[model samples]
Target: MTTNRLWRTLSGFNLSTRKWTQVNPRKARSQVPSNLLSLTSWNIDAFSPRAIARAKLILDHVLHESKPPDIIFLQEVTTAVRASLLQDAGVRGGYLVTDAEDQTAFENVPFATMTLLSRARFAFGSDSTEASEDDEVDGEGDLMIGRVSRMSLPSKYGRDALCVDLIKPAATGTSFRLINVHLDSLGHTLHYRAQQLEILANVLRESGCGGGIIAGDFNAISPEDEGLIDMNQLQDAWTALHGETGVEGATWGVGAKRRDGLGPGRLDKVAILGSKAEAMDVLRPGSIEVPRPGQESIFLPWSDHCGLSCSFTF
Candidate 1:
C-alpha cells in the first residue's frame, strides 16, 4: 500500500531515486551475449471497462508463456492492477520488477510504468529482501542485485520514466539500460512531449550505460514526433527492422473504447536510444476471445494498445 521508492518532481525538482533491488542475484547472472536478449513494451489500458478480465488475460499472456521475453515494459498500470502483477507466482520467481516493493503512490497518479527483467537474463543485488514481497525466489533468489532508477519526467500528468539498468559488474564489460515511459498525451502538447524526450536523453547521457531502449506509449500523432525521435537520438526499432509503414504500425485505435477523435495511430512504440536491436516485431499478447455460452464471443485485445517485442544485441 505504501510506495517503496516514490519520486515526486512537481516543482521541477528532480527527486529521482535509484536503488539496486535483488531478485535472483547468483543463480541468474552467469550467461552472456550468446543468450538471446528480448523485450516487450506494452501499455495495458488501466481504465478499460473490463479491467479485471483484461488484467487476468494480460498476465496469462505474458507470464504463463513457457518462454517469456527477457524484458517487459508495461504502462498505465494502476495500483489495483499492480496488485495482480506482484501476486503472480511466475512474476515472483521469474522476473525482477521495478516499483514492486516500497513503491509509493505514482506521485498520487492512478497509473505508472513498470519494468520486468527475466531472472534468466539479469541478476539482482544482495540486500533489500525486505523490499521484496512475501518470500524470495528459489535457489538463492537474492544472489545478485540489479539496478533500477526512476526520474520524474516533465509532464502535467504525474508521468515518470522507469529505467532498469543492466550494467556489467566487471569494469571491462558493456552495460545497457531499459526505460519504460509514457509521454504527455494529446496533439496539442507537442512542445511538452519534446521536453519529456529531452529529459530522457539527459538521463541516458548521465547514466553512462552503453546504450539501451526507451519504449512505451509515446502518443506519436503529430509529424513532429519523427523529428522528436531523431532529436532525442532514438531510432525507431520497428522501422529499422521493417520499413516505415505509417498506419501499419498503428497500436491504439480499434481497441480505444472512448474514441477521443485521435483516430488510429501508432501511439505505442519500441525505440532504440543509442542502441542496436537485432529484430523487432509487434506482439498481440492481449489478443484472445472471451467465451460466452449463448452469446457471440467477445474479442479483447487485452488493452487499448498492442505490444512491441524486440531483441537487442547488447
Candidate 2:
C-alpha cells in the first residue's frame, strides 16, 4: 500500500489530547443483555489439528446457543480455515483477513504466521500493498532474519503485521474496532513489545471509532511481564464489568495440553479502551451458561482458552 493510500485509511486519526466529556454514571446503561454476548478467542496452534478441532467445538456451541454474539473475533488463524470452520459450524456471516504471502521471494515475520477472523467487515493496513517498482530480490534477502520456523518454504511471511477492522451493520449504528495481533514471540525484546502496544494505542486514538475492542493472544501475562502492556489506556472488560480480581480469571491451558484447573493465568483477553469503557452493558470472562443436575456448577471445558464476551449499548 502506498503511503498516500495508507494515510487515507487512517484519515480519522487525530493527535489532539482533547477528550470527550464522559457521560455521567447515573445516565449510563449498565444492564446488558441477560444472556451476554458469546465471544471466544483461542490460539488454535498452527500445524496442530487437535487445536483446530477444539476451536471448532467452541464456535459450534456459540452458534447453537441462544443470545448469539453480535460479533466474534478469532486469532491465530493461519489462512482462511477459520472462515471455513465457522461456515461448517453453521455461522451465517463470516469475514476474514489473513496475512498470506503473495510475494514470489522469501522473507520471515510472525505476523505472516497467522490470520484474523471476525463476523465483521475488514479494512487492511497500507503496509500490505506492494508496488511494481519494488526490488523483490533485495526485499527477500532483507527479511531472511525474521523467518518463521517450521516452514520449509521461505517467503515474506514475517516482516509486516496485518490490521483488520470489523464493522457491525450500519443500520444498527453499532460498531467497534477489533484488532487481532500476535506480537513477536521472539526477535524484538521487551522494549519492542511496549512499542507494539504504543502503536496500537496511537491507532485507537486516531481511528475515532465509537467503541474499540482488541482481542488476541498477547503471548504475555498482564501486570507481571515487563514491557507486556500496562492496562492504563484500556480496561480488561471482564475485570471492569464483573468487579472481580482473582486468579481464576485465567483463560489459557485446556484441551490436548491437559490442565488440572482453570489453567495457568489469563493470557488471552478482551479489552475495552477507557475512551469507551462506559458504554459496556455487561462483560464477563467466562462462557454464559445454566446450572444443570445436582452439579451446582455451570463450568464445562470449552477450549484451551476460556472465552470472553461483552455487550455495549449506544
The candidate that achieves the highest lDDT relative to the unseen native structure: 1
Per-model TM-score, in order, reads 0.79, 0.53
lDDT of 1: 0.66
lDDT for 114 (candidate 2) = 34
Task: Write model 2 residue lDDT over 248-288, tens digit each, in one string.
Answer: 55555523244333336556665666333332221222333
- lDDT by residue for model 1 over 7-52, one digit each (tens)? 3211101113423233333355434462357778888888856665
C-alpha lDDT score of every prediction, in listed order: 0.66, 0.39
Runs off by more than 4 Å, candidate 2: 1-38, 47-49, 80-83, 86-89, 92-176, 186-189, 226-232, 254-263, 274-303
Instruction: Give candidate 2's whole-model lDDT.
Output: 0.39
